[model samples]
Target: MGPELHYQMIISRTAELRTEAADHRRVRQVEAAKKERSEGGLRRSLFGKFSAA
Candidate 1:
């Protein structure tokens, strides 16, 4: 292949990889937030029960 075509292909591949990485990172952040919220709710419920008693 020609140098110009190779360069274009490389640039396109790099952009695709960057987008994939960003999407993966966003998914991880969402999962972490959901886990934290659930844990926080559990803690509050446990405390509430003890405090009421």
Candidate 2:
């Protein structure tokens, strides 16, 4: 293969890998936010019940 073609292929592959990594990071951030919210709700509910006593 020509050097120019090889260089282009390398650049394209790098871009694809970067996009995939960003997507994975975004998904993890969303999941973490959901988990934090759920845990916070659970804590509030538990304390609310105890505080009533």
Candidate 3:
């Protein structure tokens, strides 16, 4: 293959890799937020019951 074509291919591949990495990072952040929210809710519920009783 020619140098120009090879360069273009490399650039396209790099862009794809970067996009995949960003998507993975965003998904991880969402999962972490969900976990934190659930844990927080559990803590609040426990405390609320004890206080009410």
Q: Look at candidate 3 and give me any clashing residue pairs.
A: none
Alpha-carbon TM-score of each model against the true structure: 0.88, 0.88, 0.86
- Per-residue lDDT for 1-53 in model 2, tens only? 99999999999999999999999999999999999999999999999999998
Q: On a 0 to 100 scale, what is the lDDT of residue 50 in model 2?
A: 100
Report each candidate's C-alpha RMSD, comma-separated, in the order given. 1.0, 1.0, 1.1
Model 2 CA lDDT for position 42: 100
- How big is the positional error of residue 32 in model 3, measured in Å on the Cα after superposition? 0.5
Which residue runs does candidate 3 get wrong by more than 4 Å?
none
**lDDT, candidate 2, residue 16?**
100
Cα deviation in Å at residue 8, candidate 3?
0.5
Candidate 2, run of 10 with poorest lDDT: 44-53
Model 3 TM-score is 0.86
lDDT of 1 by residue, 1-53 (tens): 99999999999999999999999999999999999999999999999999999
lDDT of 1: 1.00
- Provide the overall lDDT of each model, using Cα atoms, as 2-decimal numbers: 1.00, 1.00, 1.00
Model 3 error, position 35 (Å)? 0.6
